[model samples]
Target: MSVTRTIPYLTIPSTSLKRGFYIGFDTDTLTTTNELGTQTIDAMAHQHHTSFLFNANELYVNEDPENGGRPPRVNENGRWVPPVYRDGFLPQAPGRMFRWNNGRIEYAGSNYQWFGGQGLTYPNNETLQHYSSTTLFWCNEFTQFQMMEADATTIDIATSDFPYNRWYPLTFRYERTLSRVSASVEEQYLAGRDGAWIAQLGLQAYRHRRNRPTEGLAGNLATIVALVAFSCTDDDTLYNVLINNLAWRGQLRVYDAEHGRRPERGVVSNIYLDPENPNGSTYDALRHLEWTDGPIIY
Candidate 1:
């Protein structure tokens, strides 16, 4: 009989609890260290600080030219980057997701800047009110599935587990499910690549740099799938969303509904799953909770 090993997996937030398995293995030979050893560390240090080091998230941007544009800002093509450092602030404190949209300019020592109403030179308030606000889009099923479609390129399903087509996987995921209005915002710092972590982008919310803690102004709710690993695809040519943000999801659904009058509820009674767990309850629950239900029209 082939014995199926059942490893009791704990959620990310569970390691720090008083009564639970607090164990890990470091198989790195380093410069000169033991290859195998079971390490039991402290609750606060291991759970709150160190374990977060390896976790990663991506950030993508849409930059507008350094001149006249829409009020708040315009979302455009910059590319994706990942593994942001925890600022030890609100979102990271409570552990959630946050997205901040801003302007990209060749500024002093930094390429990106969050346009808060300062002067026309620096404290320009008019431009600030107009182009300083951030908009949040609900990540629905439409957006999640759309990540798989070939956007002018063929879909490459390399992992065969997580659904990512093109090199970039643009979906926000939460360790826990989020209610409709829950939100968090953070200023994106930099990405570590090559040898040095370069300053590429920064993020801001409805309010600009007033020293207000970005933590609570937007609640403690977490944000997920903020950015994906960016890989070079084809051209510098960009597509502008003139009117609607509805791209592939709506169009494809409409096409399928019209041509093929499919049944209302699809059937899968023969689907096999361990009766011990019964149904894809746990898995579906996580996906329904963490992943956005459909396509976000932003």
Candidate 2:
């Protein structure tokens, strides 16, 4: 006589059942691993949990309008002209703005001024070609800059003159995009001030020539090699599914030179080869597998 064994399949329903969202998976022996949790999550459900949160201030429209109204005066074009303010002072007038064809600032209006600091051959009267100021720039002042000339040296940014004649200002930094809903936004995270990782999904692999590190290749190779030799390799493969701000589920595997890529095609069968030594390492073979409706959620 022969006996038959049956397995249980689970259908995961979305929060909004009317939307017709679902995912189906089959179990090996009707036994669920503790890592999967009692209730497995659905991909759509996880997406819904994270979609509602976003920041609004990142856009320019959310900023407050500039205060201080325009000044009063009639220009040739029949428009009310305003005096421009400079450094900390504005022209003396009933209204705040005034016009000037002078030094560095051209027109004065309210709390600001404009300057056209281009081309010039000073009349025999002007002494210096460049002018620099502590608070602002003018045609007549000079502001000094520091440069880094040598390989190993500490540079001070506060000094006016270059400590080393050959160095120039260079910057190295990273940035990331963030979404918020008017609240819960911070400068550090958005600017990538420290070592912050931007949120992203998918697998990343680095491939380099066995003998040459200078010129290396990346992508597809690492995945193909790992998948084919999974049995021989220690489980160093890492897979993650993100739902909401938290990582609801994840799997981690590691591979070193000692344990190499295994020749296999399926994931589940290879993972279940040695039941007696569930936690011990084993060499197994895999066939093929597929996912249709949604991401594999544990």
Best by TM-score: 1
Global local distance difference test of model 1: 0.19
**How far is 209's C-alpha from truth in model 2 (Å)?**
18
Worst 10 residues of 1 by lDDT: 229-238
Error of 2 at 270 (Å): 6.9
- For 1-298, candidate 1 gives per-residue lDDT tens digits of 1111112462233255444433332222112113363333333321211000000111122122343211222124322221111111111111111111111101121111122111121232222111111111212222211122111111223333343322222222222221121222122211111110011101111222233221111111122111111100101100111112211221111111111101110100001111222222233432342233432211
Candidate 2 regions with alpha-carbon error over 4 angstroms: 1-249, 253-257, 262-289, 293-298
Could you tell me every candidate's TM-score relative to the true structure? 0.16, 0.12
Q: What TM value does model 2 have?
A: 0.12
Per-candidate RMSD, Å: 23.8, 29.4
- RMSD of candidate 1 to true structure, Å: 23.8
